[model samples]
Target: MLTPTDVLKDKVAVIYGGAGSLGAGVARAYTDAGARVFLAGRTEDTLRKASAEVGAEYDVVDALDEAAVEAHAGAVVERAGRIDISFNLVPRGDLQGIPLTEMSVDDYTRPVVQGLSCQFITARAAARRMVAQGGGVILSLDSGSRHGTPMLGGTGAADGAMDALIRQLAQELGPSGVRALGIWTAGVADTLTPEKLAGAGAPAMDEAALQGVLAHLDSLRMTKRSPRIADIAALATFLASDAASSITGTWINATAGMFPS
Candidate 1:
């Protein structure tokens, strides 16, 4: 049985998009849980920073590029002897706040294509190595927006694709000793800044506006608070551990009860 300490001791974890805020948080949790984590992303500077903060190794690999992701998985296995945990936190270029009627076709399809492509590439690369090694965990994160979130262009389709992929992968890989699962979380309080919102094609909100939006989200949840980065990271660390060996083929809802299980 694994304890609170050393839950992931001597394990090798590869975190795609490890430079992002959520990625960094999960990387830190994995490191604290005693995994030798490798951070992979397209930006060297940010990856370096995140790796340094978490005492992890950094690799510049684009998750969307099949060749790069495959090579990275091979490199990690070459260096670590085995790949135990694979987590994909790569962002889909999703444009929100636009109704489907007014949204361009490109905007509607971008995330659906990019999200599924990257998830497939990274998950497959990790699964091959994991199957040969006996067993491992593949983790994915999605907004849980697929249930019917209006005004978020392509987000539902993209998230639904991811959910389906995780479920199907779990079924296919389970016999091979690979466990595929996902977490559904959204509106992380710390990740929602005006600049980031603007980048997602949402209107930049002022402080008051942001607070109001957050409050509305909180009110919608069973818990009257948003899930923090730390909350998601902690859940992710546990899910990656052997303690969660029997949990697969489904997404754990970390959406503060925004949706029923």
Candidate 2:
């Protein structure tokens, strides 16, 4: 069995949006797993802070900018010699809590566009290098809201688009010794701050109401508890490691059975 301490020994992992809550968690886990992690995001301050915590390197790059992403990938390979893993954890800029009937066309399509755009920009940049290097892993993440999560406005559409992209990318890249996959996770208690929820256009919730929401999510899961950031980080680390060499072209369920495969 591969232990967490060295599963990714000396591997080079580049994470886009590496300053966010989930990205930071995964960066820490990857560092602990002995990977040489390079954290990239638009915000230099937060990226520096996250890098400090994990002893990972930091870079400022916008994942949505194709030129910027391509340059950043080249820089990573220039420094690390090769890119073994690439993960995109960028925010999808989605607005929820409003019914589609009450939403504008742009509001309903923004996430879908942003999600596919960033995924393609970053994934293609990495895939090209991976093809040259002979093998690599590309990882993505989504809320798994595609299974009809009502009131989430554009989120479901975005997730569905991402699902299709990963599947297609895997098929096209697999022959080049590259693998593409994703994770479907939602309602991770640790990633959900009151401010984050509010920013997503959810109504402000008092402590009692917040607990009620959490309980509802728990009730929907077979485990009766939502997966946390640590759980997600561990799974991501495992998937990116050589231990999961056979896994590709699929989104692994990390939703605690909220949507069974």
Candidate 3:
């Protein structure tokens, strides 16, 4: 039974923040694609629940911890026999609602430091193993800020930094047989819970306001609607597979129609 799924039959994948809504979706997609997925994040309860759904393994980790990330990659390689794909989707603490002029130095630097460090450590850990294995794919989600968003204070800045990191990592690792790419997505309704939204100080867009944003996004898009988590996760899986092996150093849009770059 040769199939596309067989493509990842023996591959090992590590996904950070796998307990989060978007991460869970991606984890399930990867697991279904036949990869041995490792779910990592802050909470054991959430990680365990997500792993069970994905039929994957779970770990508690601070993605920015270079030592811990390296160890996790080593362990995954040892257990699954190889590390094939890595996705670092750790959330940055970017709820600073102040306008750009009013934002503090600490507020702006906070997310950038956390976001870039996570991507750096996790990607470095995976890249070391992957380069040794001859090649692999690395993806860092939360790139919507690359194109720029007015309402997002630090988020846009953080994502812009990550986007740059992805490109540089791709260029450096390409010769080593590793590929790095990013997908930008924003305001996925399903992933935005009331509690999460309130905590993040996200726009208090009422039904009409939300619709307006969607409509505005739709007008800018070639497509009318935003992508679902399944859609983004599916593309992410493909990007990790041989099908997208040549897509290094590029930021793909899974944003439906909002961001055009």
Candidate 2: count of backbone clashes, pairs at least 3 residues apart or interchain: 0
Q: Report lDDT (Cα) of residue 110, candidate 1.
A: 95
Among residues 3 or more apart in sequence or in different chains, the pairs in candidate 2 whose N, CA or C atoms overlap within 3 Å are: none
Rank the models by lDDT, top first: 2, 1, 3
lDDT of 1 by residue, 99-187 (tens): 89999999999999999999999999999999998899999998898877889899989999999999999999999989999999876
lDDT of 2 by residue, 112-177 (tens): 999899999999999999999999999999989887788999999999999999999999999998
Q: How do all models score by TM-score? A: 0.97, 0.97, 0.91
Worst 10 residues of 3 by lDDT: 189-198
lDDT of 2: 0.92
CA lDDT of every candidate: 0.91, 0.92, 0.82
- For model 3, the superposed segments whose C-alpha errors exceed 4 Å read 1-4, 203-222
